[model samples]
Target chain A: MVVRKYFKIYLRFLSRNIQSSMEYKVDFLLGILANLFQSILGLIFIWAIFNRIPTIKGWNFHEVAFVYGFAIIPSGISELFLNNVWLIPTVYVNQGNLDRILTKPLNPLFHIIADGFEPHGFGFIIFGASLCVYSTLKLGLSFSFLNILYFMVMITSGTIIYFSINLFMATLSFWLMDIVSSMVLVHHLSEFAKYPLIIYHKAVQIILTWVIPYAFTSFFPAIFLLKKGALMLSFLTPAVAISVFLIAYSFWNFGLKRYQSSGS
Target chain B: MVLKSKIKKYLALSKINIQRALTYRISFLTSLLAALIQLFVMFYIWKAAFSEKITLAGFTYSDMLTYLFVSQGINNIYGWYTTVERNIAYKIRTGDIALDLVKPLRFNFARFFEVLGISFVQVFFIIIIFTVFKILVPEFRTPKSDLYLFLFLVSTFLGFLCMFSLSFLVGLMSFWTLNYWGLYYVKKSIFDFFSGAIIPLQFLPLSIQKIAVILPFKSIVFIPTLIYLGKFTIHESIFQILFQALWATALWISAVLMFKLAIRKVVIHGG
Candidate 1:
């Protein structure tokens, strides 16, 4: 019953944001087109990297494309859903704007996260899906029902993990006073997950796997989907997603308790 | 004597802006950390690419590795200049540009100097950090020669002017389109592809090379990088720096004209 109520409220937010976006038709189209250009530029970067080489350490172009394509989908979903997290440090915590959110009956974090509905993220999702199809065709893999199920499950967990990371990072704004820098820091960190993990050093691989675990979002599951035999480890993504969100939730609560409102 | 005092006012504005930009010391540290991690990512990828091959295009494995870190460092000469977009966009949005324009100060010079102020702080930090990396890492390279270093500095300054002019023009677009998100990304995507920030234009395919010829973005990174790498002779380096100066002048003129036109069109919306 509670979930249904929240769902209705979120739908209202979706419609309102869409309405505002539609009010500026040119701006709306340009926004999606800009996202399309950025994602396409990313693909070009991969192509440039591969242009001078036959393989990257044993991985072919299509396999890397498959992984890169897989990585952006979850990122896009989280971007579409929780785009407001980007504003938290600069606006909410720093300027004492959280007071309004705190006064609301709904969960403040949920309100903040769900308030933003970016149609720009659709560019990434649509492009990434098509890239996946192209690569899958090149690899000659059958997209059977079980395989499709696994992709859906893993993609869903990956989105949750992306949201959890953004939530956990935004929660740091409550304590750190200004997390915009660290926010950008982690934004760049996500780019590292687009490629295979073995190419990186032991330290980076370790940090991506354990400390931040963004590798689980794209790299591990991608390798598993490619039948590269990290089968048991890739299965851990859903568990990792749940635990990470729980920890972030508790941490957010802890910070909320310490949230002494900033003043002018 | 009157002009001297006017110059003093702009310098004081720069001083104040520098102080304002430096208050986020925690931010400085985190941005530095971010730069280092990006360097690591580039290092590993290029390292992997070069594993089975000694060179890509004309770059040796070491040349490629060094180019990655150095180009990124030089590109970030405008690290804090990213704020210029946000500042100008906000000013135009809130109708603050009118107040700013009416001031005795020339508005464009003020905005340009504001870039100088923040980037002055940034240059120091970026230099120190890159220096630290050079000492710690064997692969981090120095300029090819003292002459090349001088030429690199000349080229980079001209490049900075060109970039700042383009940025101001992009920000001016807010007069017509109130939202800044799409504009910022569009500008960034252009620069990312054309500026040689991601990869050298020489390494890219011929089609991209043909496109890079028409875009001024390559002057901002590729020319300065090649100058520092001593890839060009003295005659060629001089020609490249002159080309950068030409672009810099052209872009500034365009920005000024656009700013004039855009200012008249600014109507505070929903008022």
Candidate 2:
């Protein structure tokens, strides 16, 4: 019942964002144009790389695009819906906005995550999804009922992993009192998920898998979607999702205990 | 005599700015870490090419690595001081620019020098750490030639000019737009792609490359890095430097005209 209530609040918050965005129609439309152009430019980089070479370590353009597209979909959606994830730690540490959020009836995390809503990101998400669909079809991969179910589960899991990683970084504000550059680090690491994990050396592959679990964000999803990898570990998607969600919540709770709120 | 006072004031402001930037040790260290990750990703991409027995267009492993390091270094130096720019623009839009306009010091030049000084502290630390890591890490190979060193410095300075002018233009948008964020966002997106920051420009298609070259973007990063890799002859390097200078002059003039016009607009509209 609490979850349902929060969902309704989120829906209302989203409508408010749309209303606010609508107030500046010309600027918003220009933003959409710039965003679409930027995303297409990103696509051109991938196209250029593939045009030069047949494959990078046995991962063809289609497979690589699959990874890029899927990773971008979650990233774009996250940016569009939860743009405050980009700025929460800064606000939490610098302005002690957390104090204001703490006094509110809504969950502080939900409030922070809903602080900014960027409709421009939805364009990128749609573009990435279409690319994903086209790439899957081009690879002659047949999507069955089970595969569709698995894909949906894994993508959600990927989103959770991304969120948890970012929250964990934000939690460091309790100690370091700043997380802007740390967020930049996370953004850069996500760029690596654009290509095949195998293209990297064994050490890097280990880092991605064991240290950051970036592989779960794209590599594992691509592996399953392509049906080239073991399905046994693939079914563990929900487990991974649950673990990451728990980790983020635990870390945030712990950090809250230690947070020395800036007296503003 | 008045010029001497202006120079003294600029120097004093720059010193304070640089000192404050140096105090942010964690931000500095993380920036270095980000640079290292970028270096490694480029290295891996090139390494994978070697493993696959594929040559990257015309670039060899050495060329690729050198390009990545130099471009990465240049990017750190040229990234916009968006907060500073926004603050300045905000003051202008609100008529508070009159206070600075009346100050004995040249407002824009003072602000430029202040940011340049802060960047000196950050860029110097970046260079030292990069040098130590390059000598220690095998993946980093030093670019060949004294010409590269000379051209790299030239390119970095000109790159800063191009970006500064572009940022100034974005700042001018505050006059008519009432909010400069749209302009800032657009500037960031264009610079990130065309300046060889996110992905190498060489990896972009021939048509895109042609478009990028004609813009101020190539002058921001790629030209300098490519020159450093011995990819250009002495004549070409000289020509590239001249090109950067010409573009910088053009942009600087544009910024001045825009600022003058924006002042009139702001005064009339009470923006």
Candidate 3:
């Protein structure tokens, strides 16, 4: 019942934001166009990188794009659904808006995350799905019902892991006073996951795989879908995601204990 | 006497703006640190590529680093946002430009000087810190010669003009659509990619490189970096500089004309 209530509230919140955005017809149109250009540039960057090199650690351009494209869906949706998560910690700290959020009946974190949904992120979803179609066609992969189940399960797990990592970083604001620098660092670190982990040195690859597990967000998912890794590794996706979430949840709870609201 | 008075007011406004801009110390520091981290990341990527004992593109590891460092330097120089254009659009749309026009100075000149003054200060701090860090860091590549240095500066000046013109055009679009952010984003993405801010243009195909050369965006970073790397002959450097000058002049003229057209069409509602 509580989950349903939250869902309804989230839908209402998203609808209101869309309406607000639509009020400025120019901004809405321009924003959509701008997002399209950025997405195009990102796609071109990946294409250019792959063109220069035949294969990066045995993954070709299409394969890399497959990972990037799949990962974009969740990340883009996260930006749409949880775009507020990107701004809330900073703006709340600066504007003292966290006080209002805290007063709300809904969980403050959930409420904050639901703010600022960029409806334009839906474009990324379309582009990503197209890439998925292309990659599957190129690889000539036959999909069974079990494969469909595995893909859905792994994609959900990947999204959870990605969100948890960002949330864990945002939670640092409770103590750090400013997590913007840390946010930049997190962004830079995650940029490495755009490519195959094996491209790095053995030690670096190990760190990405074992230490941060950013690879699980994209590389592991693509690998599972493509049947590159052992069947067991594919099954390990949900387990790893759940563990990361649990770990990050602990950190968030710990930080909340020290939440000294900046009374602006 | 009027020109002299306008110039004085411009300088004063610029100083005030720069001082105000410097107050954002945290943003400046974070951006500088981010740029340095970005430079280091590019360095490592090149290092890994070279380690494979294979030459993928025409560039060696050191060449790539040098190219990227020069690009970073140029990026610092042309880093001004079209605050004037955006703010002007906002002002004009809301009739705030009337207040600005009634001020003792020429509205256009004042806005230009104010933004330039602010950017100059921001760029100064960034350059000083970047230069100091580059000096201290063993890995950072320094531009080879004084001539190369001069060309880089000249090209960067041209870059400033290009961006200024772009923001001017985008801002003027507000007269018709009354929206500038979308235009700003589009211009930013193009400049970021074609200007070789994010990735080296050399990594791209020949056709793309050919197209990029004629585009004013390359004058911002790629041409200057090429000069710094000694990839171009002195004659070629002169040619690039000439092209930059031509582009700058063209953009300056375009900005002036666009402003006139925009002003004629502008339907200022109210304050």
Candidate 4:
């Protein structure tokens, strides 16, 4: 019942955000167009590279495209719902807006997430899903009902991983005072996952899998979906996602205890 | 005597900008780290690309590494904090641009000086990183001749002007648009692809290379990087540098004209 109430509040906040965003229709459209253009340009980059070389470390164009497309879906979901995690340092911690949020009846983190819904994220979803469908068709992959179910589960797990990582980084703002650079570093590191993990060195691959676990966000799950082996490891994504989310949530609470509201 | 005093005034403004940039030590470190991570990623990707073939589009492994390092370093030096477009858009949104217009100095020139001041600090950081990488990485190459080095410096300066003018014109679009974020990303995408920051223009298909040659974006990274790598003959380098200067002049004029027209239509709402 409590969760249902929170869901209602979240939906209300989302609708209000959407309404305000729609007030500037041109800006809204342009924002979505920009994201679509960016995703297309990324595909073009891959295409240009593949034009010269047949493959990069045995991963062909379509395979890389599948991974890249899959990667964006999770990132887009995070951008849509949890982008406020990025502003935690500057807007909430430094500006002491967290004090206001703390006074609310709802959970502060949930409020932050619900309040920051971005419509531009739909552009990412559209482009990513289109690319995924195109690549799957081109590759002639047949999906069963179970496969479709697994795909949905994998996407959810990937989104959870993205949110957990972002929240973990944003939680540092409580003590560090400014965590923009750290957050940017995390962003840069995650960009590597857009391509096939096999192209990178074993060390890089290991770091992405174990330390950062960005690999599970796109790579391992992509390989499994394509039936390229590593099935057992790919299935671990949900477990990893759940654990990471739990850890990140606990860390945020721990940081909240130390958060002495800044003087604005 | 008047010209000397004006130069001093701009220099003073630049000094203030430099001090302000120094305050963001954490940002500086993170930016450097970001560059290094990019270089590392490129290193591995290019390594895999070259595993089977010794050369792709006349770039040997070492040559490509050199190009990546030099181009990335130069880009870092030329990088601006919060693109001029977004800065202008924010100022316009907040009505701070009205105060800026009241100042005696030209707006673009003031911004140019501020960016130049930040560039000085960025160049310093680039030098430190370059030196450390040179010592550690055997593949990093220096220009073969003093003439190439001289041409590179000239081309890079012109490239900065070309990039600044383009950004300034984009910033002027704030007069028409309520939000500049979309425009900013679009502009950045064009630069990343056309400027050869992500990949050398030569590696691209012939049709795209032809298009890139006509655009000023190539002068920003492609031409400068090629000149730095001594990929062009002395005469060719000189011709490219002249081309860069030409584009810089043309873009600067266009930016000035756009700003003049745009400022007249500036509607500062909700001040």
Candidate 5:
């Protein structure tokens, strides 16, 4: 019953944000177009590199594109729903807006996650989904019911992982008010997910898998879908995603307790 | 005497900018760390690409690595400063730009000096980091000659001018538009793709390469890195430097003209 109430509230918030965004229709459209252009540009970068060489680490162009597309979909989903998590550090902690949020009856976390519903994120979803479908068809991968189910699970897990990482970084702002740099560092590191994980050094691969776990967000899932090796690790993506989210959530709460309003 | 006084004024403004940058040292350190990670990622990608062959697309492994390192290093030295762009846009949106317009200093030049001050600090740290990487990684290579190095530095200065002018124009767009966030992303995507920061222009399609050569974006990253890698002969390096200068001058004039037009349309919407 409580979940339904929150869902209704979230829907209302989404409608309001959409209405406001629509008031500036050109800006909204341009924002989406820009995101689409960026997504296409990233794919073109991969394509240019592949044009020079037939393969890298035994991963062909289509295979790498598949991974890139899969990675983007989850990132897009997270950006759609949880981009506000990124602003926590700057808006809530540094700027002391958390005090106002704390006074509200709604759950602060939910409020933060749902308040800023960017319609531009749909551009990422459209581009990503189309790329994924095209790549899957081009690769001639036959999908069973189980395969489709697994794909859904993997995307969900990937979105959670992306949100968890952003939340964990934002949580750090409670102590380190200027955490934007750390966010940028993590963002740059995550760019490796656009390529096949095998291309990186083993140390980097290991770090991406275990420490940062960006590998699971796309690499492992892509390999699983491709029926490549590392079956055991690929199957562990959901578990890793869940654990990371839990840890990040607990950390956020812990940080919240420590957050003394700047009182500006 | 007027020229000397103007120089002193800019120097003092730059000093203040440098001090402000130091106060936000963590931001610089993080950005440097981000650049290092990018370098490492690109290094591994190229290493894997070169595993089976010594050369691809005219770039040997050493050449590719050097190009990657130098491009990223140059980018760190003078690439996008989002803070500056945001400051300019925010001031314009909030009507604070009127105060800036009334100042005696030319707005564009003042902003350039301030950005240059920050870039000076960035280049210092990047040099130290690159020096360490060179010692630690035997694969790293430097320019073949002191003359090439001299030309590379000159190209880099031109590159900085090109980048600043582009950013200034983007900021000036705020005078006409209520929001420029989308424009900023669009500009960034174009710059990243055409500037050869993500991939060398040679690796791109012939048509795209032709387009890139004509665009100012390549002057910001591709030219200096190519010069550093000795991909260009002495004659070609001279030509490329001249091209960069041409683009820089053209962009500066366009930016100044756009700013003049934009100022007329500037409507302080609210307090």
Candidate 6:
């Protein structure tokens, strides 16, 4: 009953967000264009890299593209659904706007997440999904019906993992007041996951896997797709996603309780 | 003299920007740290790419490493610190450009000086960090010769001029366009490619290389970094320095012309 009620509210807010975004058709279209152009440029760079060398570490061009596409799916989903978390440090916490949010009857976290719908995310999703299909075909791989079901579930879990990290970063703003740099730092750290995890040093691999766990979202899923022999460890993605989400969610709750608005 | 006072005025603006670099504390530091992380990723990616071969695309392992660091270092020193496009766009949107226009100062020169001040700090930090890396990490390398290093320094200053002029040129579009962001965003991606900030220009196919050569973008990172590597002959280095100066002057003049053209259409709405 509670889930259904929240779902309805989320749908209403989403429609309102889209309506407002649609009001500025040029701005909206330009944003999508910008996003698409950036991704395509990144693709060209990857192509240039492959032109120089056949593979990086044991990963071929197709595999790397697969990993890149997998990374984009989760990132795009988080961007579409909950990008407002990125503004927490600079906008809400510093401006004492949390009080206004606190007055709302709905859970502030849900409200924040549901209110955002970046049209640019459609660019990411479309590009990523096509890239995934293109590369898979290039590599002569095919997903069975069951594997397709698994793919959808894993993509959701990957998005959840991304959401957890973003929420965790935003939650830091409650205590630190301004965490733009830290956010940038983590953002760069995630960029490392664009490649196969094995390409990095052991230390980087360990950090990305255990500490930040971005590898589970991007690399492990790609591995599951590439090597259909089913590396059982890839199944750990959902569990990792859930654990990080709960931790980040709890941290948000704790931070909310302790949030002292910048009333001055 | 009037010229002397104008130099002093710009210098003072530069000084103020250096002081303001730390006004937000963690913002600057973490952004630097983020750049470091990006460099780290590139380092590993290149290392992995080079594992099987001594050289790919005319760059040995060490040469490639040096290219990556020097290019990234140059970028870290001068890039994006000039948030000129967004600032101009916002000011134009909110009609704040009128206030700036009435001021005694030329806003373009002021913005340049401000960016130069931050670049000074950035150069300082980059030197210190690179020196530390060279001392501690055996993999890191320096310029092949002192003359090459000096030439690189000269080239870098000109490159900074080119970058600022190019960015300011784009920022001028704000006077005419309501959605200046898309243009700037597109420009950034294109800049990253043509500038050789992502990969060396030589790595590009011959056709693309021919095209990228004509653009001013390569002067920003490609020439200075290649000079540091002593990849060009002494005569070629001199030629590159002259080329960069030409680009800098041309771009700066064009930007001024763009401003003159754009200012005529300035309709600042909804202050």
TM-score of every candidate relative to the true structure: 0.93, 0.88, 0.84, 0.95, 0.94, 0.95
Candidate 6 shows a clash count of 0
DockQ of 2: 0.46
lDDT of 5 by residue, A81-199 (tens): 88898889898788888898999988899998888877778788899888888888888987689888998999999999998999998899988867888887896787888778888
Per-model lDDT: 0.83, 0.74, 0.72, 0.86, 0.85, 0.83
Where is the poorest 10-residue window by lDDT in model 2 chain A?
Answer: A230-239
Q: Could you give me the TM-score of model 6 versus the true structure? A: 0.95
Separately for all candidates shown, the number of backbone clashes (residues 3 or more apart, or on different chains) is: 0, 1, 0, 0, 0, 0
Ranking by lDDT: 4, 5, 1, 6, 2, 3
Span of 10 residues, lowest total lDDT, candidate 2 chain B: B78-87
Best by TM-score: 4
| Cα lDDT tens digits for candidate 1, B1-271 | 9999988888887787788768866776676677677677777888888887887888987677677877887777776344577689898777787798779988788888888887888788888887887788787678878999999999989988988998888888776676788888888788978999888898788987998966899888888988888788999999988889999999999988988777666643324
* Candidate 2, B126-208: lDDT as tens digits: 78977886787665666567767777788778878887777777766665554456555666678878887656777776788
Model 4: what TM-score? 0.95
- Model 6 alpha-carbon miss at residue A190, Å: 1.1
Clashing pairs in 5: none
Give the alpha carbon lDDT tens digit for every residue of B211-261 in model 5: 888989999999999999888999999999999999999999998898887
Model 6 lDDT tens row, B241-262: 8999999999998888888777
Candidate with more favorable, higher DockQ: 2 or 3: 2
Q: What is the TM-score of chain A alone in each candidate?
A: 0.94, 0.90, 0.87, 0.96, 0.95, 0.94
Tens-digit lDDT string for candidate 6 (A1-264): 889999999999999999988887877777777777777776776788888778776678888888888788778887788788887887788887777888998888887778678887777787888888899899998868987888898889989988899889889998785676777678667787777888888998899999999888888877978983347668988999999999999999999999898895
| Candidate 6 docking class | medium
lDDT of 1 by residue, A13-118 (tens): 9899888878997687778878778878878877887877878878988898998889899988887877898888767888888888999999998888777888
Candidate 4 regions off by >4 Å?
Answer: B80-82, B267-271
